[model samples]
Target chain A: MYPRAFDYLVPRTREEALEVLAERGSEVKVLAGGQSLIPMMKLRFASPTTLVDINRLPGLDAIDAVNGHVRIQALVRHNDIIRSDVVRAENHLMTSTAPWVADPLVRNRGTVCGSVAHHDPEGDWASVMLALGAEVVAESRDGGTRVIPIEDFLVDMFTTALEPTELLTEIRVPRYERGGGNYQKLERKVGDYATVGVATHLELDEAGVITKAGIALTSVYVRNLKVTEAEALLVGRAPSAELFGEAAAIAAAACDPTSDIRGSAEYKRNIVRVFTERSLAESASIAQGS
Target chain B: MEINVTVNGTPHTADVEPRMLLVDFIRSTIGLTGTHIGCDTTSCGVCTVLVDGTPMKTCTMFAVQADGRSLTTVEGLKRNGELHPIQAAFKEAHGLQCGFCTPAMMLVGSALIEENPDPSEEEVRWAISGNLCRCTGYMNIVKAIQLAAQNSTTGGTAE
Candidate 1:
């Protein structure tokens, strides 16, 4: 199906794109990889009046480690993250989650920033970003740039803290000194959204005790569910199956999933509990190895 | 509204509406109908094409987005009337039954072999995971891709 008629703006630079966004506001949509936005437009679920194509804008595709964070630019595609040795080294959750974002075809064109900015609760990137304590960067013609914590950035389903006048330029994931992470997703088939997704990050100190922990859920809540209660419970403790099971129980209780064709609500919550425990166990092993 | 795209080694410039999808532009405007559109919502990868050598779903991408870019459709797999290795291997392995998804399957398979000359069966399956084939139960297709990968001496896209 063809999308509704709209004006297409090929912005040659970041400044030009921001100018159009600042002026057109909600009317103009920023087209990054077009993996999600274009499909939504074709379905008429989202029909913006104009699209500011940012693909031509140079220098927004780099993935770099800067200031103790890995900055993924606006144009960094999902496949780019999958192939990045830096991401593999710096953020294990991101690298582990990269291959599972859609498929190889979609990953070639879908941007990490676009997926995170789109903020679909079913999207795996946001949960991973949340698990890594990622930051979002927005820019406009008038306002310079604002850094938003991932928690505040994702306000609701397909909704974000971003103003209509602003464009999401980048996402910054903190570079941990020693951590291991894993993303466990349950999908019926390839290219399907996650039924129950769990992203776990465990950072251990020199003594192998947990220094920091991050656990987030996907497709189980109104938004990406960051299990702060579970995270807190693991921070002062060491990696153990029993401790992970306790945290997993808290995560299962925290999630709000409704019954659908995927499974009954009870089954989904059980999967959440099981997946949380499994992912945390895997993450702890990797952390101990590191 | 004019976009310049190189398809199948030929540069074509056209003035198209912004809503025109790349699949439509290739089939309708460029007159290359080998790339079929199965599910326009990007579910079935029958409309898969190479945008600057990376496989992407053309049905979800706009023609304007292909401006100043290169695309490789199924038609590009053949060079000088010779069938691409993947195409020949598909025939030998009986990889196709209905032939509705043949063009895309060949294109994706050829592209995968180009990237990894010796792709494992799992890698080949993962590479074509976006594409859905209702025929052959994917066993013969996997064999076809492995056949093509083993037979090719040089990394060939036949482009």
Candidate 2:
């Protein structure tokens, strides 16, 4: 399949990128990694008049710890995240989730920020970022930048809060105190998208009481489902099989899964419930230092 | 747009359309057809090539995006008319039957061995997970990669 013809612009600096966006914002698509956009273009689902290739832009690919947040530049590939010692040390969930994405070859070119910006309902990054309470940094042509919470940034399926002139530059995930986190996805095959995916983060006090909890789901709804009700159920509670089961049920009820080829709605909901229980159990065990 | 890329130790500069995919550029423009296009979508890695020594699906990337970069295709895996160890192992172990996915499988296997010289059987499987094969059932493919890992003293690269 061949994508429609378009003008390609390679910006050497961040300011140049923003300037191009400012001028051709509506017609131009910012190509970062091109893992998702190129495919969409080939499928003719997207046909931008111009593609602002930002791959040459310097200083936008660093993974750094800034002011208690692990800041991943927009160009940080999934393979980079998978290999980054900083990511593994600060957020183990990202490490676990990175491999579940397409595959090793695709991961070498797919960017974490690109995945977040694409905002696919079945993408794992949005749910992972939601579970980590991550923030997205967007810069516009006016030399102004804004940080958006993951919840606000991911508005709906294939949609985000970013304006046409805005370029998503970085993603910042808070470096919380060491905690236990896990991402579980039920895909039909190795490289398939998730039928139902769950990401869990748990913080525990020394006495083994849950101090904080994040439970997010993917592929069961139009957007990343953060089950705050289930999260609340886990807080102030000790790790137990019964508690995990209860929270899983709450999370499953919150999902709006649709019947499709992957499975029926009821079956998907059951998978969600079961995966939630299993992931929470694993996360809780890791949290309890077992 | 004109792109200057080095493929298989040879530098080539050509004028190409912005939407021209790297796979098309390699096959049509540069006249190297070893990299097969199984699925234009990124799902199938039969179009996999080494961009800057990392395996990438060429069909999913634009030729303009690969400007001023280095690429390695399956055609580059041989030296002095002799097959590279990975290729030899694949032939000896019968890694491929239909041969549509062999080039990508060999390139991906080369990349895997280059990164981890002693990759286990499970690691080999994971490395080639993206490249799909309808024939051979992947048993011989895995064995070929393991055989290459054992036979090659240095990394699986032909210079």
Candidate 3:
């Protein structure tokens, strides 16, 4: 099926794109990569009157690392993020999770920001970003900018708290203090959406005891959720398989999974438990190696 | 709007509607039927093509977006009246049957080999995961890519 007819605007700059979005308001959808938006449009799920194409906008395609933080542009495709040297060094979780997104062809066109904006509950990046304490930089046409924490960015299933006139411009992630992060996802097939996924970021003190633990679970809730209880259980404890299992149990109990084509709600909940354990264990290895 | 693009090494400029998809432009306007459209949904890689050395789903792109870019389709892979190594390997290995998916398979396969000279069986399988084969000739298709990677003339083996 074809999408409804709509006016297409290819803006050359971020300012021009914002102006178009502000002028069109809810009637316009910003097209970046089009891996997510176009498919939804073709399926008649999204019928915006205008599409503001931002692929040509200058300076929105960079991966910069400075001040122990990595700033990624909204237009950075998944493949480019995986190939980025800065992401490999500063945020290895992004590098590890990006390759498992769909496949090479989809990754070549899907952007990290686009996936976040699309707000698919099953998307891998959302949970990873949340666990890493990433900040989303959004700009509106009124020259106002707001930094939305990943925890508050997502409102519900396939919904974000972004305004119609707002454009997602950048994603900022701070470097971990001591340990590293890891993402674990379970998919039914090679390129299908995840049934359940977990992202864990752990930092240990010099004494080899866990100082900070951040955990986020996805595909098992309305949106990516931060499991504070699971994280609290990890603080001040040594990394152990049994401790990770307890934390994973807390994470699984914290989620409210829904039944879909992927699996039953109970099945997804079980997978979330397994993935959380795996992610924590993997993060611990990176922690100990450092 | 005036849209100009180099398709299969030949440049063409046409006045296309602002909403014209690149795949439609190549297939309908340019008459290069070698590029097939499987699912308009962009989920299938049947509309795959190379845009300035990078593989992209043509159906997901606008003809205007490709105005200044170079596009390589299945029709462009032949050189000096000889089939490209991917095409040669496919022919020798019988990598196709009904042939509807041949163009897209070759386009994605060739692009994968171009980016990764030597690809493992799993890597090659994952590279074309976006393309679905109803005839299920995947075994021979994998063999074709392996043979192509082995030939030093095709491109130096990657890994």
Tens-digit lDDT string for candidate 3 (B27-93) = 9999999998888876677888899978888888878888888999999998988788888888887
DockQ (CA atoms), all models = 0.87, 0.87, 0.62
Arrange candidates by lDDT, descending. 2, 1, 3
The lDDT of model 2 is 0.91
Ranked by DockQ from best down, the candidates are 2, 1, 3
Which TM-score value belongs to model 2?
0.97
Off by more than 4 A, model 1: B154-159
- Say which docking band candidate 3 falls in: medium
Interface Cα RMSD, each model: 0.8, 0.9, 1.7
Q: What DockQ does predicted model 2 obtain?
A: 0.87
- Output the lDDT of residue B85, model 3: 84
How much is B129 displaced in model 2, in angstroms?
0.2
Candidate 2 regions off by >4 Å?
Answer: B154-159
- In model 3 chain B, the worst 10-residue window by lDDT is B150-159
Docking class of 2: high
Q: TM-scores for all candidates?
A: 0.97, 0.97, 0.95
For model 1, give the TM-score of chain B: 0.93
lDDT of 1 by residue, A1-290 (tens): 87889989988888888888888998988899888899899889999999988888898989999999999999999989988988888877887898888988899889999998999999999999899898999998898899999999999999999998898989998888778999999999989999999999999999899999999999999999999999999997889999999999999999999899888899999999999999999998888777
Q: List the residue pairs that clash in candidate 1.
A: none
